[model samples]
Target chain A: MLTEERHQLIRDQLAADGKVLAGELASRFGVSEDTVRRDLRELAKAGQLRRVYGGAVASAPFAAATLSQRSRHAVEEKTRLARAAVGLLSAGQSLFIDGGTTNEAIARAIPRDMELTIATNSLGVASALVDRPLVELIMLGGRYVPNLGTCVGADTLAAVAQFGADLFFLGSCGLDVARGVTAFDSAEAEVKRAMVKNSAGIAIAVTNDKLATAAPYRVAGADAIRHLVVERTAPAATLADFQSQGAQVHFA
Target chain B: MLTEERHQLIRDQLAADGKVLAGELASRFGVSEDTVRRDLRELAKAGQLRRVYGGAVASAPFAAATLSQRSRHAVEEKTRLARAAVGLLSAGQSLFIDGGTTNEAIARAIPRDMELTIATNSLGVASALVDRPLVELIMLGGRYVPNLGTCVGADTLAAVAQFGADLFFLGSCGLDVARGVTAFDSAEAEVKRAMVKNSAGIAIAVTNDKLATAAPYRVAGADAIRHLVVERTAPAATLADFQSQGAQVHFA
Candidate 1:
């Protein structure tokens, strides 16, 4: 196979299986493992996949905004959105919190006496909830992807699927009425999808600028999210766009 | 079975069942409950197993073993032991680090350039590793018990069993030849036991006072551990006892 053709097949295998073993690919193409490994390395450098011990995982979301990156993007807007998101919770609720700056802020703003059970895949979120004795914390196990944070690999996805929660506090890289809810990382997207699948309701806390943007991996449609939380700075038209998609939009 | 072997089997029973009755253990060993109680007492003194009414609940060396507590106990000694423990590690190794003051110190003392895969149950240890860019951190998931400061329950135990590491750094409340490797909490004991089961080798970092004292939970026997790391202040005879039990003692 041509090198480019082989690369395409490798990417296709990754997209389908979420992973590609170099040894298995080598036999299929009748090529040396070294050649296959080199292909994986190139793909990794090009932001196409992540190389693991014996294989490669699909690349993380290419969106430049990391959790810490998003933290400094829009300060007041995120805080307002976070406080608004916290208001949605009752005295007792079990929530699956995704990893993101807005979500970390929301975790920090959690009321002390809420008597809540929070299950999070984010190491930062878990750290934030440490001193809050009243809250029961469940840390989800998974492969830790540096910078992007903890990912819901197979173990995490299975754990999330087997459990049910009262609500899901969804965080997103992009949320457009037309494109729906999207994330940068595929494993993260898969985890969010599972959280939505297992929870009774889904509430997304989004910044104003992220409203009309789109990321590579789609988690769900904007309409599938029961509640859309946005800062008051969000334009009226953008809020209308989300509300028209059947979401109950809340402006902080 | 030898007396030490009997102690080990009883400890295993404690691990698998989460508790062991003195009467039942007595009958199982063809001894009276009084003899069983003596065995339990010895194990309890070594912090191998906690003594409770009737039989024993898991040992929860509750009084002085919190991560913060240990940090204050032996500053210089723990630091020296931690540095030596890091020296035992090669650049590309993976490790399962249990939760303890000394263990957290060791995690912090980890060289920044040693590319490692660290799986840990301690929130403090995970937090220490956060800014480290090269290390791949895997936070073990489970129900977070507040005071213990780590995840421990069925989930953590199951997760430990499913994973393997290059090395296991077993932390304990006490380490003595007579009592073996011991911890304060039963689940911690069980998790440490699993770490030993999953890793290629086991190395323990202990302080001077922890040398002769024993906690309630027994994690392993002296022969089972390949390396015993200690502070220079540890007494010569105590070090000899561990050496006699088949551990290579390193005084940092």
Candidate 2:
């Protein structure tokens, strides 16, 4: 059989069984375990599967990657942006923090001594602030979308409407000068839009990669961003565009 | 200074400042870094402090140790009891799962294919069920207590009242035939009491060590427990007492 045949069969097996053991594959295909391992490694590198101890499991669906997977990308950049974004907040202000790894980082970077009232639809954000004594946390109730680690649906939107926050830390999937802020999922975008509408001010911290990009659902207009935080590596022209819209741009 | 005196000073410093650096302590006390390390190790062994890389932090307050700290105790026993308790559950039933390490274990052990509606106030339990496709999760919102990994206050109690569940997985701090199921914190106990009231059946899964013991706040009476899951090593008399209260007992 061709090498492609083996790889194709492996992918099919993983899709059907959720995982595939290298030894079992080797025995079934009359190939060496080393060949199976090589195939698994290649598949993992291509993002087709996740290799484990002696096998591989199917990769998370790309459209809604798990929170843990999303957290693993651009970690240091996210932390830098998060720290810069959290610094923009004043003490004693009530805020709505959205879901995303960057937002989760901002939740952690919040000063221990600062007092705040934080309402969130993000499980990770709530978990991060639970230890701090000065922060009063209110979690919004709804259907939990595990991959995004945020609540959604009509219940979540209704809960988000009840609170008019001083600020909203928007979780950005894609941001564009012309297209405004957007999210990958429609339900998430709707919830974000509610947050944008309910808060007096809005802030978003994004890595350079997200700039000038647009996801499917538009969350708000560029002018809606009161405070925009980006890494120093972001294009100067892009920064100027945001600044022209009256956003106070800060670089991490 | 004598070793005991150094240990005392270390405790004082930790209490005053919340943390103590080994190098700073050694220099201040005219001792070697190794001596400070030894002191920190001893204190950590005694549960008086938590040792970090270069220093020691004050131990969590005993009255409200963090949930992470509590989860470290009796891990294997809890897993066993959790598995046994989860076995008593059926598909298509709605459950109210409370907060505690054992209850968190039960949440993790829930069958992925079973369709269930779960309402919980536990950060840990919600986190565990988020990835499961068949579980419809509802997070009860309130003031998040970091130590307990649970929400409390009036909001939590009010939220609990809205749900009528087929089963309540009680997070047991202590259980006794005379005192019934109890919790270390009064607020947590109140939430547990509310869960007990809203559910048709109550289940308590406990390690043998928790049997016949009592905490400060009473959650419910012995007869309230519809299902009791205990380790096989529990005292026969105690098991009989639970059985006599019309509770169906299962052993892990």
Superposed Cα deviation of residue A227, candidate 2 (Å): 0.7
User: Candidate 2, after superposition: displacement of residue B41 in Å?
Assistant: 23
CA lDDT, every model vs. true structure: 0.76, 0.81
> TM-scores for chain B, in order?
0.71, 0.72
Per-residue lDDT, model 2, residue B16, is 34
DockQ score of candidate 2?
0.20
lDDT of 1 at A28: 96
lDDT string, candidate 1, A8-45, tens digits:
57865654344678899999999999999987876553
What root-mean-square deviation over C-alphas does model 2 reach? 10.4
**Candidate 1, Cα interface RMSD:** 19.3
lDDT of 2 at A184: 94
- What TM-score would every model get versus the actual structure? 0.72, 0.74
lDDT of 1 by residue, B58-167 (tens): 45422112321222236556777898988888988889988776787788789998899999887767766766788888878888877677888777887787789988
